[model samples]
Target chain A: MGAPEPLPARFAPGARVQVRRADPPGHVRTPWYCRGHAGVIERICGSFANPEELAYNRDGLPAQPLYRVRFSCRELWQDYAGNAGDAVEIEIFQHWLEPA
Target chain B: MRSHHDMGGRPAGKCEPSEHEYELWEKRVDALMMLLSDKERQLLKVDELRRNIESLGADAYDRMGYYERWMHSICQTLIQRGVISIDELGRKMAELEARDGRA
Candidate 1:
């Protein structure tokens, strides 16, 4: 079984948050593209077991809240040639986000 | 180690259209991987499976197709977890190949 109970979600939908810039050497779920990128929480995906610990065969204690953060492509890619209206989205853990 | 599977934005390649059908072994591999993750089996979590697939070296990672990656990862995972011994797996594989040879 996972954490006795799912951790209460910290961020809510439409909340502005920034992805923490980090280069963890171990197994990480945060995608490098979205690192240090500011985005809005599109939605709070259901909490899931912490993959970081699970990768090492450790018991992923309390589950972590996951959020679907959406970002504009132009901001994510310095020279993104796609349409100006294009955007990118990725699921990030609560631990990786800080108030912008 | 930071694996190549994290292709997030570091890329400059055009996406290729799939023009071929799934070979029989590929389809079977897909189904078998799903079964391993079943609640009853619990041999591997989907995330662990992903990590295993990403852990492959650059050569095997690029040389193999999508399902081939899954097959490779699944085999390694089962073996690492000690759920299925190598000898048992080899015997089953040989049986399967012999059946195919006769067909």
Candidate 2:
């Protein structure tokens, strides 16, 4: 089968976004911690086949745009006692992000 | 449902990281993973490996070492792809065990 048409990159760098909180079965690269958290787009990391579909041995065509999202440590953990300025970055697929 | 493999940010004891040289079998498993996932072969995708590893219940995940999990996933992937059958694998393993017993 041929590669699926690529999805367009919607959010630009520095755009405010939130990770989707929905949980579905099968393989998901989006970690549970980041779900429902708000973050800013750090940078664009190009597009790749969706790992969710790839796990099933399917041709994960229509590659999705990937972005490095930056979230403050406090935003991730409610009881975080570390430096308030501390932040964590994660590479997230476009499908998992929505405008904040 | 939260999978056992998703252990990010969970409260846990302090991590005492250590390193050790890979054993022969571990090396073989790593090499096998690379060769199978290589572009030309493409018999296995890293996603498949992760899926299988995640499917392994929490108990097995905790008990098995890193490469042991990878080895299990590799065999499962090959079987899922019909590249080899369970009966064939069982027979081969039994044959090797018999030979070792004789030795």
Candidate 3:
């Protein structure tokens, strides 16, 4: 069967959120550059099975909400030598985010 | 800790983009991926393939090309899932090597 329906969203569009900095062993999709950084939710990209669990051949039930979070370039890079308005958008899962 | 594959924003040299025609084996690997991950089969997942690639260690990761890594991961994942046995793979490789006469 196809993936289950997306889980209900927790944070709405434009909500502030931060990526959790935890680094557990095993497969993960969250990039290291975006962790522990604050950003605004650009949009919800629907939910899907957790990649970490899927990597281990397990059924990732209760799919987590996914979001395209927009972060300032300066926030992600200390010396971003670019425009102040420059930003990067990354797809993050609900389990990796916390209200900021 | 950051995995070796997660190199975003890290210090790096200029990125020189280039493209070339994919070799036959590369295309075959792509087809294998599509077939293995097809809905009816469900023998492998894209996530599992990526996890295996990431776990290939820094040395092999840098040494192998993109499709090379994918092929390696496909074999590794199939073995991990008990879809293929190591002895079967070894025998096949040996047979091919003997037929090819170490070329």
Best by TM-score: 2
**Which predicted model would earn the best lDDT?**
2
**What digit string (tens of lDDT, one per residue) describes model 1 on residues B1-103?**
3468787766568889859888898889988978888989888777677878888888888899999888877887888888889999999999999999999
lDDT of 2 at B58: 97
DockQ of 2: 0.90
DockQ (C-alpha based) per candidate is 0.52, 0.90, 0.83
The docking quality of candidate 1, as DockQ, is 0.52
What lDDT is obtained when candidate 3 is compared to the true structure? 0.93
| Residue-wise C-alpha lDDT for candidate 3, range B1-103, written one tens digit per residue | 6789988987789878988899999999999999999999999999999999999898899999999999999999999999999999999999999989967
Chain B TM, cand. 3 = 0.95
* TM per prediction: 0.86, 0.97, 0.95
> Arrange candidates by DockQ, highest first: which order?
2, 3, 1
Residue lDDT tens for model 1, A55-74: 75666768889999999999
lDDT of 2 by residue, B3-93 (tens): 8999998778987898899899899999999999999999999999999999999999999999999999999999999988999999999
User: Which parts of model 2 are misplaced by more than 4 Å?
Assistant: none
Candidate 1 residue B17 C-alpha distance from true site, Å:
2.0
Model 3 lDDT tens row, A1-59: 87777678989999999999999888899999899999999999988888999998897
Candidate 3 wrong stretches, greater than 4 Å = A1-6
Residue A53 shift from truth in candidate 3, angstroms:
0.6
RMSD of 1: 2.5
